[model samples]
Target chain A: MAYSEKVIDHYEHPRNVGALDKNDPGVGTGLVGAPACGDVMKLQIRVSPEGIIEDAKFKTFGCGSAIASSSLITEWVKGKSLDEAETIKNTQIAQHLALPPVKIHCSVLAEDAIKAAILDYRSKRSPAKAAE
Target chain B: MTTATATILKSLAEDRRNAPARPVYLDYQATTPLDPRVLNAMMPYFTEKFGNPHSRNHTHGWEAEQGVEQARQQIAELIGADEREIIFTSGATESNNLAVAGVARFYKDKKNHIITLVTEHKCVLDTCRHLEQEGFEVTYLPVEKNGLVDLDLLKRTITDKTVLVSIMGVNNEVGVIQPIKAIGEICRSRHVFFHTDCAQAAGKIPLDVEDMKIDLMSISGHKMYGPKGIGVLYVRRRPRVRLVALIHGGGQERGMRSGTLPAPLCVGLGEAAAICKREMATEAEQLTMLRDRFYASVTRRLPEVFLNGDEKQRIPGNLNISFAYVEGEGLMMGIKDLSVSSGSACTSASLEPSYVLRALGVGEDLAHTSLRIGFGRFTTEAEVDYAADRIVEAVQKLRDLSPLWEMAQEGVDIKSIKWAAH
Candidate 1:
């Protein structure tokens, strides 16, 4: 399948690829997908005191689409508030990357990673608010 | 290991700035480009001599008939068969169908059982499945871990009711060559007709109908650098192997496959067969060297990369490998400039892994990461070197991003960890 220029760009020069300290209270780490299923993405976001995402980093084991999806999301979620980041749906990621139907799961995983990372960060701040 | 591969390819890339933008074609198992000589032989038949081979009255018919008959002879010669035994068909899929279904249906009254390998092409497997619906029993025999069919198991599976034994000569995905000679001997002793799908085997390897004791064999034109839409089914004439015609009309191909034969395709196949016969020795040597060179270099630089099939019995042009901790599709993407196929079913319409590799007992993780890198007669050493470097580079890059690789490096048993469902 022909990857879109956006996917090619992200795959060739992926942004924010690294690991964050999972033990940090302000850091939320989302490890979603599986190696057996051919994709496993670790997306982490460090939230500031005011609820803004201070930084986002990701590492993914998957096809170009999966890596590109996670890489693209890391760029998208930074500086956004926790609530605003939660609004980042998979469709928007899919559209932004022009991912094909076969690679749509990559975008879904990216969206899930964002939410999961946000949840991890929120739980550290206020355990009662982590119910969602 | 991944870094080493990338380094090799990166250096090669520096020298290939002016190279063609298109990815190098390495998936020869899928199809091969037509040889220029074959094209030259076919050009006249396409324009000047476009007459139906079955037409009897006109000069146009005679010319077309000559082309078709000559092609039939050329194809027959490749497999050491008489010209009369060759039947033209649409392609290997149809040829396989005619052999599997046609043989079983024709002998259903006396024999209702058929035996085939698990690694046979989808067409052969699906055809046998269709026959099962018709009440004909089929034995899908398992292959050894090396991807070779068990001759003893095949012998034990044959019963008095067995009419046909269908096995592929060389696997398309792994390129392991089956023991056709031994299998043929067992089939012959048991009075069961032996049919081999030689689509991937035809011009790449030497095949003789008499020496192998094969009753029916399928040959695809396009796989051997011939034109598409043309194939040959070599039915044994000495023992008189008969199959119920799959396509019935106009009594063409001895009433086996009835259709107007394309003269150009016939001539192209003929020329291709002749060229293969003449160049098989040198081509095989060159391709084998190139294939091994690529394999040795990749494995030398890359750790945790495994070859999928038996190294010794495999086709010289095939080099299937699995890069641990990296998905095949992702690796393919990392090396977008190189054309290859992943064994992972995700690359296909289905989400399952390759059945062919699964038959060899390869783990699901390895299967998902496998790539089928095929070399051909036209492949150059430069291309092979470039491909090896690019693959290494991609595998390294993908591995760098893989969480599993990190765990493996840290001595963690990845299998023991429970993965999150989402």
Candidate 2:
């Protein structure tokens, strides 16, 4: 199947394709998807004290759709507050990429990665509250 | 940089942009382009000499019948069999179905067991599945890591109740040539019928029905650069291999396959077989060199690449390889200009790795990352070089964006880390 132009764009020139310092307090890493399923995405977000996402990066081992999904999400999540990033649905990403039904799961993975990364960031900032 | 160098780079970019957008053809295992000579031979049959071979009263019918008989002779000569043994069908899939299911059903009372490899083509396996439902038992034997059948295992599997043993001459995905001679001898000694699916092997390899002790064999036309929708099944005449008719009608093809024969397709397959018979030796040598060149060039520049199947025992035109830490679909996308199929192409819609690789004990991760690049008689050295460079470039780009690759580069055992239990 031919990939969409937007998918090709993201795959060819993926934005923020690298890892953040996972050990840093400000960096929250979310690794989702499974290798056996033929996709594994690692998305990371760096949050500022003002609860806004300062930077986002991703590394993905998958089809073009999955890489594009993660790359597109990294671009979308940056500069948005963690709460605002949480509002981004997988459907939006799927529509923006013009992904086929078979590849919709990639967009879902990206959305799950966003939520997981936000939770990791919140827990790091408030460990006692997270424990409760 | 000098202005001359900058200008050269700009022109190169422009040339690349203006280049033809078609991907270079490399998936020969799937199908091959029809040979021009074969087409030329079939053209007359399609136009002026159009007639049903089954019609006996007309001149048109007589001419068409002669064409089909000549075709039958050509195909039989290539395989060293009598012309009377050749039965034409739609293609190898139908040929296999007829050989497996037809033979099993005809001999169902005397023998109720059929044996075949797990890696046989889908048609053969599915035919066995259908037979199983009809109360016949089947044994699906596994291959070794090199994708070769074990002779000792075959000897142990056959029983007095086993009527037929069907194995393929060459694997479609991996291209490993099975030990056909050994299997044939065992089957002959045990008084069992031996059939081989030679769709990928007929024109590419040397085959003799008598020497191999093969009772029935399947041959595909398109695979050998002939027209599609035509194939041959070689059923031994001396010992008279019996098969229940799959399609019963006008009693064409000695009553095994009953249908009106397309004279043009029959002529095309004949010409193709003749060409293969004459040119196979030199063509095989050229293909082997080109395939190895492609393999060597890619493996030299890329690290952590593994060739799947037994290299030495495989056919000349096939190379199945796995690029570490890269998904097969992603790699194909990265090298968009090269037409290659993933090992998973057989079950691509299901997102599963190839059963052939799985039978060989290949890990799911590597199997998912595997690509099958097939060389053909038409492949050139220049195209191979271009494909190698593009593949290497794509793998590097994807690896740069792969977290697993990064971890491995840093001496981290990726398998040691617990993955999400999705």
Candidate 3:
């Protein structure tokens, strides 16, 4: 499948490619997808004291679409409030990348990573809320 | 021109200039470029000599018939079969269908069982599946890790009711050469018809039907540097192996395949077969050297690069490898300068890894990371070096971006952790 120019751009020069300190109270790491499924994306977000995402990083082992999706997500989630980051939909990512139907799952994985990271961050903030 | 149009045109020109050179072709198993010599021989037949080979009333017909017959002889000579035993088909897919389904249907009353290897091409496998719908029992035998059929297992699988055994000559995915001679011996001993799909084998390797006791064989033209849309099915005449006709029409190809043969394509296939027959040994040596050089260069620089098929028993030109911690499609994208096939599910419409690799017990993760690189007659030493360098570079780049690679570097076992399926 021919990748869109945007997908190629992200794949060639992925944004925010590294790991944050998952142990840090400010850092929330989301590891989504599966090795058996041929995609594993580790997306991390570090929140500031003001409850805004200060930094985002990702490492993805997948096809170009999957890598591009995660890279694009890192860029989209950084500098946004947790609520705003949570509102980022897979359709916007898929539309931005012009991902084919078969690759829409990559965008979904990216969306899942965002939600998981936010959930982890919220859970870390309130251990009792995480139990609920 | 308008300012916008002028700017667009200027950028278009720049884009054309900056466009990458044609990707170096390393996927010969998919199909090969037509040989120029074969094209030259086919030129006349396409123009002034365009005549139906079945048309016996005029000079045009006679000349076309002679060309077709000569092509038949050329193909027969390459595989050590009689010219009369050669029947022309559209391509290997059709030939395989005819060989597997045809034989099964012809002997349907006496035998209801057909045996074939799991690693056989989709054509053979799908044909077997279709036969199953027709009430024929097919035994899809699994191959060993080295991608070779167990002769004892094959022998035991054959029953009194089994009429045919279909196995591929060389696997298209991994290039593993099956033991056709041994399989043929068992089939002959047990009174069963043996057929092999030699699409990836015929020109690249030495095949003698009589010595191998092969009753039927399939060969594709494009796979052997010949023109597309032409292939051959070699049926044993001495043993009187008969197959029900798959295409029925104008009573052509001994009434087995009935269609007006394209004279040019037949000649091209013939010329290609003749060239392969003459240069098989020298070309094999050259390809073997190139393949080994490419393999060594990739392995020396990269760790955890596993060869997929049998090292020694594989064809001289193919090297199927899995680069651990790197996704196949991502690696292919990184090496845009090289053309190759990935065994990853992302490469196919169906999100399933290669059945051939899975049959060999290769893990889904490894199978998703596999690439099949093929060297052909036209491949060069420089191209091989360039390909190897690009592969190493791409694998390293992708691995750098891989979380799995990071985990592995930290000495973590990848299999121990539970992974989300999605």
Candidate 4:
């Protein structure tokens, strides 16, 4: 199938692709899934005390669509509160990127990866609350 | 390169100019056009002398039997094997299965171990995999970057119980020629039976069974421009290597493969072998030139392009190239004018990258980016030049739309650019 113009747009000029430091207290590092394909995508976010995502970065090894989706997600997640970022759906990412169904999984994986990262950061920040 | 392709280029130029411009077949490796002479010779068997070769009944059977035997002689002659040693089967897949699993079953009690490579054709690898289910131990040898198996590692992999060693004569993907001669010698010294899936190598390259010391060789009729359902399993008759039958009915094909013989296919295969014997050297030389021209044009135009496998050691008809950050399938999609491949046609339908590439240590990204371009007897200089230039153009167009390219331009090594972990 031909790639959508938007997918091509995002693929050709991906907004965010490099990494962020997980060591920064404000930075929440989310390293997640797919050891089989060896595609390890890290979505790191620097969260404010008020729970606002200050910055975001990601690294993904996958197809053009996967890279674009991860790159696009990091760009979307930045500056939003953790709750706001949590609402970002794979469908939304797919629609924005015009990702086809087969490739939508890459976006969903990225979206799930986003939530996973936020959970990781929150778990690091408030251990009691994370456990609760 | 005249020393390289003089005769081939001269003939190819004439063939392309004279050939018809219809039915644009890109799947040359699948099968080839039947030579008219081969067809004419086999016509009398169908109409005037139709009979079952196995039938000891009458003159009809006698005539048909004679034709079958003659075709058998032609096939045997093509590969330099004795007529009795060559047993015709459906195709190489069956031929490979028979050789691999046949050996497995024969040595099951005496020798439980078998050695093969992961990059083998599905027929061989899957047959070995099936043998594993049946309680036979199989060792999978890995290939180097160029797809060559290390003879030393092969030696180490062999054991007291090792009964068979199956490596393809030439790799279907990347067209890397393996160290079959050395591997054959090693197996000979070890007293292990050596088998080669020469499906790709049989008609393309010069394969001498006696010189190569290949005991049981697998060859496909279609790959050599013969009928698809016919193949030759060259089992050494002098020593008479033992193999258990995979089938159990009618005791046809020496009880190794039991089924009604396909006279038409056998005749077609015989004709193909005849043509191959006459034209293989000249065809290979021409294909080699086309392949080189294809590579040179693409490399000259495209930067950051990589060719997979060893260049010098590769077969003359194959070119496996990777366009970094661009998906091979996507590039193929954009290339409507050209009919080609993303490697062996077997894994073409699967979205998963080629296992051959994975075994060669190529990353999924690169594997997905790879394209396997094959030049056959029919491929021309114009087509090669067009394909090469178009490939560069296609990759550039795709990359220009890739967000990955911007990061690349910004000096962010995609490899070093770590993703923020979730």
Candidate 5:
């Protein structure tokens, strides 16, 4: 099957590749899944004290589906708040790429990574700040 | 080590030394080196035994005719087909075309839809596509990742308009075996003619024409230590199916394909089948063990390699694997000592990755990296092991230089990283 042009785009010159320091209060890293063909994604968002994502970086291990999903997730999570990123659905990624049924799991993985990264960033903050 | 094969390579080397300008013949799947014994059996016909059984006027044709009959019987016995059922053609492609086009054209008025799979040999796929262009509605069934057709899909796809279904017995690239018997039974019940391209499996596997309920099947001579340019199409006489002729003129092959038969090639084909009948069991067993050994060694030495197809349900002589980072041509260039193919022999020269692998949901990168290693009657255990080592080392060396491997090493989930399109 010819990869959808979007998949090809993400496969070459991937956006937001490399690591974010999870140790910094500004950095929240989300690690999810085993890297055994099931796409595993590590998304990190550097958040401001006011709760907006200031920066994002990600790494993905999987097929074109995995690559495209993670790539789409990184793009989606960049400027959103923690709650906003959590609201982003896997369906959106699938719909964007027109992912077939078999590769839908890839989008789901990316959505999960976005949530995990937001939660990672949220857990580092104070309860008062979270409630706010 | 088999003494027979150990000496063959040396003889090959001797020939290379003597004639440095000769073209190296590596296209084994297209045909094979005819055994000397088969050549001897056929030689008498060219000389004193020359005769046409059809010519009642003289002994020359009669003597030549006896060899043809004997060879026919041998071929029929080889596939466990009835003697009257085996019809000869120029090669497997012709046989395949006849089986498909013949049935579709015969039932042209009654049925318009034909079913075939995407992973079939080019001949079968092309014929189906050609039929489609001719206004026959064709449904190309998709194969699963392991290269086997989903039976439920087959059951669901057949309708009154469906006149036939053709699926290859053994995939030429991935080496996966389809469930032909189950499919044949399904088609038989549906009254749809079932055909299989058995070019790779005819001599390698146990094929009984009646047991599978196959309506038509294609076989090639060169695939099984036989001479090239001769093939067999097994047309079951039961219930009487009809296929239109692809070629016209002489009224040979029961008016299906009319051409002057290549006597020597046909005789060689029959002899090849006979030899396969006598030696298949032992040869298959040996090849399986060697293949297993090769896979184990290669996969162990190089971690994270992908073995394509249903590992358990493939031909005993075939091992196809996709090394993660190294491309096929680069690895092949590194391992120059051994000769093999990257995909189906017919399409290897094209820069495009095989259409068969693409149908299996394989991406372009991994698909191009695939290599098909086939062990024939003469491939010895030592060669398999040595080739395995060469492959493993080449993969390792290539991986060392790859950025993909570096990412995997750094615990960087490359799958999570969204890559941009090139």
Candidate 6:
């Protein structure tokens, strides 16, 4: 499986790799993909008061494609609002990374991480709405 | 820094980047580079001595037949069988198919049962599956956690309906050496035929057909530093083991396999077998030392590195290990200079981890994190050290990027967390 230049670049030098304070009110954490399934991606987003994603970080235990997917999503989400990030499709990521057919799941995981993080952030802001 | 020093460093970095050096090959179980001596011995047969072994009219045919016969003798000598018992096939897959399916179909009237290990090669398992489709009952015996078949279980599995027991001499994935002699004895006592796929063991380990009582054995040329596209199946002659021919036309190889034999590949396999017979002892010792050196270096420097198979009962050239919390494919990418095989699902089209590792009771996560490092006859001490260092470095790098590793270090039980399955 030959990785594209972008995937190789992100794998070799992953961007925004670290953990944010999961307990922080501003930080929304999305942990997706099962470890037993050979991938576990933890993508975190720190939302600003103005509703922008001020910072993003990710840590992934998976193949080069999964790590690259997470790394690329982190970079893409950092400057976007929650709504903008939620609109990011997995196909766009897959196309940009030139991932092969089997590796499209890595991009799907990245998209799921974004949605999960946004949901977690929205829930933290309005507990009543989340309970409903 | 001085401008001159910076210029030199930049050039050196570029030189390193542009260098087309081959990756240090550590996947010998997959295939081996053809030995120079074997190639030299095959060259004459390929060019001037080209003749169909089945053709008996001219000197050309006689010369090719002589080469094929010599190869048969050499291969037979390696496993303590007579030259007449050695039958040529396309490769190990064909040989395995011929041995398992041929024998079962030949004796299908009296016996409808076959026995084989769960950890046998895909070819063997698929052949058994095919036989099952044809109404033959196959008992897929499970192996112990150490990757060895339970001898007691084998004794109980044989019945009057059983015709053959096919087991592998050495595992392709984990490098576990099965007790062929014990299995053979059990089969013999039960009045059943025993077959073993010795592709991974032929040139690396000692095999005796007489002592082990192996009725049918498969050998691959490429796995033992010979050319590809040629293999041997040793059919015991004294007890008169019989099999229906898989291919029929020219009646070559005693009608077991019928095609014009490639004299070049035959000579290559012959020379390779002869070389292995002469040098197996010293070669195995050297490989063991190199393998151990690699294992020691990596394990000493890294934490949570687990060996995947029986440590002492495995082949000297194979080291299958799992770097905890590090995905195997990602680790392979990190160490691009080293060639290795991963048990991770990402390496294959399917999303399942290696069935061989799973059969050995390795956890799914560990199975996804395993790497099979094969050290061959040409591997050097320096190469081993370099590979070990690269592996240690890659594992550390991947571990740092792993959330599970971080959580484990913080005293959080990784299993306690509910992971969303994708």
Question: Each candidate: how many clashes?
Answer: 4, 0, 0, 20, 26, 0
Q: Which candidate wins on DockQ?
A: 6
Identify the runs in model 5 with alpha carbons over 4 angstroms from their true place.
Answer: A1-132, B1-31, B50-54, B343-351, B416-422
Give the distance in Å from residue A63's predicted Cα in candidate 1 to where it truly belongs. Answer: 1.7
Go through the candidates in order and give each one's DockQ: 0.53, 0.55, 0.68, 0.09, 0.03, 0.74
Per model, the share of native interface contacts recovered reads 0.65, 0.67, 0.76, 0.03, 0.00, 0.83
Off by over 4 Å in 1: A122-132, B1-20, B347-349
User: Residue B307, candidate 1: how far off, in angstroms?
Assistant: 0.6
Clashing pairs in 3: none
Q: Higher lDDT: candidate 5 or 6?
A: 6
What's the TM-score of candidate 1 when only chain A is evaluated? 0.97
Query: Against the true structure, what is every candidate's RMSD?
Result: 6.6, 6.8, 5.9, 7.6, 10.9, 6.4
Candidates in order, TM-scores: namely: 0.93, 0.95, 0.96, 0.77, 0.72, 0.96
Per-residue lDDT of model 2, residues A1-132, tens digit only: 888999999999999999989989999988887676688899999999898999999999999999999999999999999899999999999999999988888899999999889888888989888667
| All candidates: interface RMSD | 1.9, 2.5, 1.2, 7.2, 11.4, 1.1
Candidate 4 stretches with Cα past 4 Å from truth are A1-103, A106-132, B1-49, B343-351, B419-422
- Segments in model 6 whose C-alpha atoms lie over 4 Å from true places: B1-19, B347-349
A best-first ranking of the candidates according to their DockQ comes to 6, 3, 2, 1, 4, 5
Q: Per-candidate TM-score, first chain only?
A: 0.97, 0.96, 0.98, 0.90, 0.90, 0.97
Model 1 CA lDDT for position B11: 74
Q: After superposition, how far is residue A85 of candidate 3 from its true place, in Å?
A: 1.2
Which residues of candidate 2, in runs, are more than 4 Å off?
Answer: B1-21, B345-349
Which 10-residue window of candidate 4 chain B scores lowest in summed lDDT? B343-352
Candidate 1 per-residue lDDT over residues B1-422, each given as its tens digit: 24444565577667678675778899999999988678777877867788888899999999999998999999989999999999999899999999999999888999999999999999999999999999999999998999998888888899999999999999999999999999999999999999999999999899999999999999999999999999999999899999999898888888898888888999999999999999998999999899889989999999999999888998898988989999988888888788899987664445678999989999877888999999997899999999999999988888888878877997988888788754
lDDT of 4 by residue, A1-132 (tens): 567777666655667655666667777877654323423456778899999998887765445566677878988888899999999999998898887766766777788778888888988888789878
What is the per-residue lDDT of model 6 for residues B1-422, given as tens digits with 9 covering 90 to 100? 34444565578668968998879999999999888778777877866789877788999889988998999999999999999999989899999999999999999999999999999999999999999999999999999999999999999999999999999999999999999999999999989999999999998999999999999999999999999999999999989999998899978888899888889999999999999999999999999889888988998999898998898899999999999999988889998999999998785667799999999999888898999999998899989989998888888989999998999999999888888776
Q: Tens digit of lDDT per residue, candidate 2, span B238-352?
A: 7889999999998999899998998999999999999999999999999998988898898889999998889799899889899989999989988888888997431245667
